[model samples]
Target chain A: MIPVTIEQMSMRFGAVKVLHDVNLTVQAGECFGLIGESGSGKSTVLRCASLLQDGWRGRAMIGDTSVRDMSVAQRCRSLQMVFQDPYGSLHPRHSVRTVLSEPLKIHAIGDAPDRMRAALRDVGLPAEFLDRYPHQMSGGQRQRVAIARALILDPKVVFLDEPTSALDVSVQAEILNLLMRLRSEKGFTYIMVSHDLAVVDHMCERFAVMQHGRIVEVLDRDAITGAGAKTSYARELIGASLAYENAL
Target chain B: MDPILTVRDLSVHYPGAPVCAVKSVSFTLGRERLGIVGESGSGKSTVGRALMRLLPDAKLSAQTLTFEGVDLLAASERQMLRLRGARMSMILQDPKYSLNPIRRCGEQVAEGVRTHTRCSKKQARDKALAMLKAVQIRNPERVYDLYPHEISGGMGQRIMIAMMLLTDPDMVIADEPTSALDVTVRLQVLSILDDLVRRRGIGLIMISHDLNLVRNFCDRVLIMYDGRVVESIAAGQLDQAQHPYTRGLLAAQPRIGGGRGPLPVLKRDPAWSQPMEIPV
Candidate 1:
């Protein structure tokens, strides 16, 4: 079953059209990647699909319900988004416990204390971190808290926007492993956006290459290793990533 | 050939901090590129700043810190100012914050030249335009008058390079210079640096977290961890590094042909924080 779908989606900011007739379908329990450089409308697609940007044209569906028709409570239960910058996404004044429980409190979900502790453990953070502020945590620890906040509600679909780009190589490995482990245990669908081809290849099985606000090609993981990408832009991106690897 | 700069037993400690940020780091640089590779809070950038005496708040001490036989630690502030832009210069990570927002790109480059050399405004402006062209900026005249906000990120970085190289500094310390750039543009920027090092015979200290880039670009590499140099190896010999920290970092990066699997997280060892054993 398809957990998330976008058909003929178009978005314009006044005179500028950011997304042009974008379409995507994510399967249940699959990790789909959206790969592009800056200003490629990949994040806009996530925003439109998650109902964060309601001014887009065309239909976006989460499970069986269209995004426009879903109620606030239904939307909260179905999909959630994780932003690129963990430091900016989290509230500085709030403790880790407070940050995880706010979504539950807003949705009127009972047993907040138990759910918060479980969320911390699920993200591999100690229960003692509940009273710590965002500033007190490292970049990796803060990102884990952000992931916990996103998954605390048990949403069916989650969108990750450049999840580990800000982290160090070692810390990035830890976060990527944690994300993969969580997907297997919970069986939730993920839509990950990134500019790094190696990272996208590791996390996602099938990915779409976006250029100038349009998805130029969709390729499988096997295509990444082989010369199977159809578009010149996608080929260039792959070659650049490979060149960066060997550049040292 | 004699070294351009030499540092021995260098350490930095900011006020109120229990542990030193950089601990007894020692190195020697000639006309070749040296890379300092480490994660955040590993004191890689601190080493760079301490060399230039830029960290005002940090208390710095060294057995011997010399640049071309001149004692940097004992140099007065006025003498250091004269040597800064003329003999030694730095390129920051982001050109957006480094370049002045309101000044014309050409004027900024010309200002550096005029301050360093006893040149007229016209002479300084001509030298600036020539340097911009050297960095591969097409239509130098048009770009010369543009402000920082008008140009693209790649162009802005080139402009910063043009400005920094105007005075022909003998040594350049670049801190994560290409991290903010796109992969394709990163190559272009790096090649520009490579050209400068070859043509001018200037020593370079590249501070970055990217191990692959350092391995391929620099002649030597220093693997720093927790304010200490854990391993120092030739760039070509990075794969044979003996330190666990270096091996762990190499394994963490995902490769293209590598299949999907959980990457191994680095387990920190408390013993790695002990004083470094500098090779004689």
Candidate 2:
């Protein structure tokens, strides 16, 4: 059985079908990438899986337990989400300690202090960061805090939605490397959404190319490793991404 | 050939600040695209704004700030007004903040046109629609009447572009015009800018954080760090850059097929932005 299975998930907003008949699976200890342009419904998929977004059809199964049946607490511990826009995703008013510990308090997890400290260390954050607020920190540091907040719950599945899009290149690499390291040490499933083909190509093992609320194609690294792709849309995306990369 | 715009040991400082926001920055813009790229707070925007003398109420003092053949740094308010938007206009970063939210976009653009040419209101309206069409906006007739809040970010950017270009300025300064846009739409906006500049033969200064975009879009590329141009090179040879700072930036980014490994970390040298370059 897949670690997490999203079967025929569909979402709508006032007659607008934002996502339709979307299916995806993230294996345990594997990075599953969802690559698409803006409004491709990739974020919606992460939102659905993390239970951040409700009012949907079909089953989001975390292992054998259906997401439809899990309690709020169960979902929180087993599924955590890291949002894009590090600045906006985090509460500017809250200190790093508060942001990480508040989730534990909500889940009624005891020894909150010890848990917060451990969480900070897990994401490679120094203890000095504990007293600092999000606004005082750099973008990469804030993103690290965000990662720590997600992993503090020790979730079985971690959903990162455009985690490093806003960050500069040098800072972005640090965050990306941190995510990979944390994944190895923790052994949690990762479902990451990004529009950058280079990022997808570098980090992901299995990828689903999304377009206009549907999964247009799914490819392994070996499928179209180089030169070009079979689908015209994929080729265009790959070409444009390549152009940007080569230009860099 | 004489430079369209020249800066001689230029610097812009905030009030009571020891260091300038932009420091000793010297560059020249011909009738071509010149991109100034750097991270946030690196002072790329200050350079662009300083060019047009629109640096807000901030304290600004420069040795030589010349526009075309005129000495703008010493120009009076009346002289500056005549030069402002009509001669050299700036396309600001965020349209939502820059545009008047309550005013209709068409009227605003038409007003921009009227500032320069003695055209009737109806004639100016027609020209606004034509400019909108030039930017590839498919139904200019309908979009012309909408307020800034009513349009999307990309659409709003297009409107800003129309406004800035309407006056037929000699030099156009665009500050992160497409940073808020998606990848596909960024290409669209840039393509429009490229077409407009080429057709009009206007000097262009594009300020952005994305080095790759700057390298490809601009003719001459200036890599700014901590308010100083660390290096300037031909845009086509950006990858073959000589500066350690530039190489570090290029190394830090992950390319499409740049194989996996420990990512390169940029060591921030105290001398990275220092005026002291390696002895020749």
Candidate 3:
């Protein structure tokens, strides 16, 4: 069954259209990727699908229910998003315990502390870190806390926007491994948006390439890994990525 | 050929820090591209700054630091000022923050030329325009009058390059030069730098965290871990690096055809933090 779907989604801001007729769908337990450069409207699609932005024209369905028809609480329970910069995404003044438990408290879920501990453990962080603030943690540790917060609600679908772009390469690898492990263990669908072709190829099975607010091509793992993209823009992006690899 | 720059036992100590930010690091450079690859806090940027004497607050010491037979460690402020843009210059990461917000882009470039050489206003302006063209900026005349905020990030970076190379320095130290650029534009910027360096025989010190970029663009690579040079190898010989940190960094990156699997995280060893002998 399809867990997430977007049909002819469009967004405009002050006479400028950022997203035009974008469509996407993800099966249960699948990881779909959106790849593009800056100003490519990939983030707009995620925003509209997650119902974070209103006034977008289209149908975004999570299972059988449309996003627009869902209540705030229902949407909160169904979808979550992890932003690009963990440093800015997390609350600076809040402790890890408070940050994790706020979501459960808002949803009126019981055993908030236990669920918070479980979430921390799920992201491979120690329980003792619960008392520390965001400033006290390292970049990788802060990112782990961000991931823990996103998964605390146990949502059916999660949107990751350039999750590791701000991290060092070593820390990025650790985070990527953690994400892959959690997805397999929990069986949740993911829609990852990134500008890096190699990272998308690593984490996603099927991916779409966007350019100038339009979807230029949708490719499978084999096609992307083989650099067999059909469009000239996709080929150019791939070529640019490969040029660095073969720089010697 | 003799090296253009040489250093021995270079160290930098911040006032309140417990340990030296850059430990007894030493290297030599000729008229070729050399890369320093390291993670944040590994002191890669500090190395570049130490060469240029830009870290005023830090206590810098070296057994020997020489550039073109001149002692940089003993040079006075006034002498160093004359040598900065006239002989060597540094390129920072972002042009947006480096450029003056209120000044015209062409005037900034011409200012560097006028300060370094005896030239009339028209001559400096002409030289600035030619330098902008050399960096491959389309419509140089129109861009010269615009403010830094008026140009795109890529164009701003090109303008920064034009300004830095206006005096025709003998060496350049670029600290994460392309980190702010997109992939397509990054190639163009790098090629511009590459061409200028090749044609002018200017030594370049490229400091960045991207291992692949360093391996592809540089003739030699220095791998830094925890404020120490863990490994130094030729670009073609990067795969044969003996240090565990270098090997781990290479393995951590996700390749295109690499199938799904958990990337191996680097296991930090306390002994690796101690200084080691650098192999030639």
Candidate 4:
């Protein structure tokens, strides 16, 4: 397990500034959360850190090494991302074998067959799922395959961007539990971004609430569950979530 | 004090499909908010579409499906079209897919007014602007001209709500209306909807997958499983729901500061899928 850090990260798209001086430190094996409304640049933070997005004015560090200094292959081996939509994230044409084996093949890793089988097994899918296409699997199963592919490379840190948002509550519960079990079993650090405060409060140790491209408040589980948040925006969010009667 | 809508023994069967998508679903809606919730393919949205007569290919069979005392099942296509968007309307899930891509926001909202009522273009535009303002859009004039792509997701959803509420329909079926929106934005939209539902005294059927959203927003809740209503309970009393399915759904949710251990997965019982003994 390794710590991930972002320093003064700022990003812009044309005239619109999407992220603003976002500084965060996630200690080793910590499951940190980023919460906010839509367009709050939560996903942008993940993209910037995961190297999917560049040209942002900031530095991202994973462990002792700077992210910018690492090669594409090196970054893949260190950290991976699981997207929100299981339907769209997985390639429709690719079989489970291809999806799992591609990363290993790209990194020139040996033992593709055994590794692919083990990856599927890790996510609670049977070995027979390796031959199935994305179309053949259910939404929850597809998400598990996506999670398996992310862990196939055995990345130390995993970026989960609204992983359970698209799923049903029952399926969401199962996925969340699977994620927690995997984290504890493998000792992998997680950075999850979700709009559901309940999910964040359940999974995260500490979380940052973002608004207007800025981190408005950083809160712990106690702040979420105990005395409530300090900022009005955070409080308003909490109140709104608690019940519709409390909504402004 | 008549109910706005009454549904009895509604079933939907797709052609060549072995089983019906919706089976023997029944409910009655007064001038109150009713939430229909379940997992994907549980047929919550199917129930909504069957009520609207939107599913053309699917064979819909209902013993009694009436809205505002009009028989929805027996109504002719032309008659149903007139009743739709005037007395009853449906708010779709995604504004991105629902809103007209090529049309301006104001024009789309105005089109609904013109379609349902005899109004001049100027009158429709004025009413559309008024509706947009009611939805809490900051600058109706500025947003009026903006296309669907130009507006944000929250703004787009609000605009969609404005369009749906433009005709002052008696009953509105919002199917996952706020699922596409952010949490804060979702509550804002729901409050706007809540205000309209109370002030206008219109019945609302909110179809969603989120239990917390339904628990807080709706007065009553129906838990559907595999094309059947497994349990129907009051929103506030969801905690003490009777059915195993209802209890499973309630327990499955990860409450903020509730539990630290791995969440309990729903162990589905075969009996939950069997026909329920209809409550009086």
Candidate 5:
């Protein structure tokens, strides 16, 4: 059975149609990527699927169950989202311990202390980090903490929205490696949104290109390095990303 | 041809700080694109700000700092005011904060021209419109009337470029100019800068953190580490870099179709921060 599916999904903010009739499906344990320019509704798609946005018309299913039918608690248990900016996504005043344990307390998950430690350790952070606030940690460390917070619920699916854009290249490498390792170990499906074609090529198995609120093309990983893109827009995006001179 | 700007043993120290934010860094620029790349807190932006005389509170010291045969360090504030926007200008990172929020786009560009040159309002308006077109902004008439909040990121960036390049400055210091832009729009903005450099022979200093971008766009590259230039090499020859920091940075990038293993993380050695021994 497919782990995630969206059929005829559409969104509108006031008079502007941000998303057209979009359709997508992801297999179990697959990393699906959405690529586009700014204002292309990539983040909006993630927001809609993750229940962060309202008034979107369409059917979104996770393993045969409609996403809208799930309760808040069920949704929290089934899916989690990691945002773009770690500095903004994490609460500035909240300690790491509070950030991690709040979700557990809300869900009535016992053994909170042990689970918090395990979550931190899983993300390759030391246990002492729990006492630190977001300001005390570096950008990379804060991102790791955010990852731990998202995975603390042990959700089957995770939405990554430009997870490494705010970070330096070296730190981005660390975070990307950690995400890949965690997915392999836990078998969690990921729907990532990024504008970087190289990052999509490195992590995703297949990706869809969005422009003006529509999916222009969908291709596998091989297409990024080859001439498999059928549309001129996709080809232009690919060429521009590969070499700086070609974009001119 | 003479170099446009020259620096020797330049250093900057903030008040009450134990160590200087920028160590003794020196480089020279001619009629070419020079890139200064480093991670956050590596003082790349600090160097740029020092060059532009933007930092007011910080203590700046250099053995020799000159621009177009004029000593910047010894120049008076009145002299700098005349030379700033007219002779040497700076293009900041984001237009949202750089451009005045309440003003129209064309008026802001025209204001830049009017601040340095004696021109009537009509003349300045025409110059602003022409500069906007040079940055490849289609429908300059419509965009000119719009406010800063009305334009998109790419258009906003192009407008910022237009404002800075309107007066035809001899040197431009662009600090993370395209970091806020996406891949496609980034190239377009860069090509505009590239054209200005080639056609007008302007000396450019691009400050950024994207190694791949610097490698592809700039003629010469200076890799900064701990407020010092650890490696200076031709942009095309980055792979043959000898510094461990540069090699670590290069290996850390997860290239397209790269091996799906754990990427090599950067490991810093404290010895790298020490001054290099000059061979006598």
Candidate 6:
């Protein structure tokens, strides 16, 4: 069954239309890539899905709930988000236990302590990291905490925004592996936003290319082999990713 | 000819740290572009800062950091300040961080000229406009008056390049300069640097985390891991790098034309973080 459906989802902030007639669907347990350049409104769509912003005019159906039409508490159990910058995303003073357990506490998940510990282990984090603060841990460890917090709810859909951009190569590899494994085990649909083509090529099964507030091309993961794009903008992204090594 | 700059036994130690941020690392740069490639926590940036004598908050000591014959280590604050922009300049990684937000772009560029020369305010403004033109800013006159935030990221970087080049330093140390820019814009900036440095025969030290860019752009490559230089090879021989860390770095990247599933990840080694043993 289709897990999430977006129909003609157009978002405008005052006069600037960020997303225009955007339509997408995420299959259950499938990893979907949302690729775009900076200021291309990729993060805006993810924000709408995570229900962080409520002033959007769009048809966003997450699971059985109409997201655009829901109260915050009611939709809290269905989706959770992991932000890109782990340093800024997580509270510096908050313990890992507090950060993870707060989500469980909010969603009314039972046995908060046990659930938090289990979630940490499930995300490939050591049990010792529970009481540590974000600043004490490396970037990879903080990202894992963010993942654990998201998964503590057992949300049907997880929204990851540039999950591994701030990490080094080896650490990024470890996180990527953990993400792939977690998806298979938990069976949660993923809608991840990133500028890295290799990442999109690796983790995503189906992907959409965004340019200047519009979907230029949507392709399956298998179609990433070579020179094939109906739109020139899509071609440019592929070309840029291929030729110019993007900032990691 | 003697090396453009010969650095020996360079080390920068943070307060109360056991080891230096950079160990006894040594290298020499010539007239060609020398690319220093490394990741975060590596002493690559420290190397550049040590050469420029800008390592504030850290204790820096080098056996010898000779810019041609002048010793950067022995140079006084006033003397170094004079040489900084006029004799040698650096383009920082991000223009947003380096460029004065309060100052107009043209005024900033012209100030760079006025610091070294006896030029009048109007003459400095004209020189700044000419520098902008050299970087291919079409309407240099208009952009000169605008503050840092008003310009785009690429435009800001070009303006920075224009300002630095206006001083016409004998050598330039660019620390991850184009890494913040978009691909097309990055290539544009690289081409501009290439043109300016080559035409003027100025020595260039290009420090970046990107191996591919360094290989494609520089004349020589220095691969640094942790705090030491693992390998230094000619640009043409980059692919043939002998060191395992260098090979691993090359392998970690996904080539544009190569087919792939998942790209290979670099294996970390603890030894790379240790001090270097520089032979005499």
Most accurate candidate by TM-score? 1
Report residue B156 deviation for candidate 4 (angstroms).
2.8
The 10-residue segment with the lowest total lDDT in model 3 chain B? B251-260
Per-residue CA lDDT of model 4 for B1-280, tens digit only, reads 5788989999999999999999999989999999999999999999999889999999999899999878998999999989888888999999999999999999999999999888899999999999999999999999999999999888888898889888999999999988988776787788898898889988999999878788888999998999999888888888888988888887888887787788889998898889977572
Compare the candidates by lDDT and give the number of the best one. 4
Ten residues in sequence with the least summed lDDT for candidate 5 chain A:
A239-248
Docking class of 5: medium
lDDT of 6 at A115: 83
* Interface RMSD per candidate: 1.3, 2.1, 1.2, 2.9, 2.6, 4.3
Q: For candidate 6, what is the DockQ-based docking class? A: acceptable
lDDT digits (tens) for residues B84-136 of candidate 3: 98889988899889999999999998999899899999999999999999999
Candidate 4 segments whose C-alpha is farther than 4 A from its true place: A227-232, A243-248
Chain A TM-score of each model, in the order shown?
A: 0.97, 0.94, 0.97, 0.97, 0.97, 0.94
Query: What's the CA error at residue B117 for candidate 1, in Å?
Result: 0.9
The TM-scores that each candidate's chain B achieves against the reference are 0.98, 0.95, 0.98, 0.98, 0.97, 0.95
What tens-digit string does per-residue lDDT give for candidate 6 at B1-280?
A: 5588998877789888887888777888778899999877788988888888887688877788899788887889988998899988999989888899998999999998888999899999999999999999999989999999899888999998998889888899989888767654677788898899899988999998878788877888887787788777888788788877888777765444345345566777787666545332
With a 3 Å backbone cut-off (N, CA, C), the pairs that clash in candidate 3 are none
Error of 3 at B155 (Å): 1.9
lDDT of 4 at A155: 94
Off by over 4 Å in 6: A69-74, A221-225, A245-248, B254-265, B276-280
| lDDT, candidate 1, B106-223, per-residue tens | 9998999888789899999899999999999999999999999899788888888888888998899989988888765787888898788779998999999999889877999999
Cα-based lDDT for every prediction: 0.90, 0.84, 0.89, 0.90, 0.90, 0.82
Query: Just chain B of model 4: what TM-score?
Result: 0.98
Q: Candidate 6 — which pairs collide?
A: none
Native interface contact recovery, all models: 0.68, 0.58, 0.67, 0.79, 0.71, 0.17
- What's model 1's lDDT at B275? 81
Over the true interface, candidate 2 deviates by an RMSD, in Å, of 2.1
Docking class of 3: medium
Q: Write the per-residue lDDT of candidate 5 for residues A1-248, one digit (tens) a residue.
A: 13999899999999999999989998899999999998889999989988899899998888888889999999988999999999999999999999999999999999999999999999999999999999999999999999999999999999999999999998999999999999999999999999888888888999999998899998998997777999999998888787753321
Q: Ten residues in a row with the worst lDDT in model 4 chain A?
A: A239-248
Clashes of each: 1, 0, 0, 0, 0, 0
The true-versus-predicted C-alpha distance at residue B180 of model 5, in Å, is: 1.4
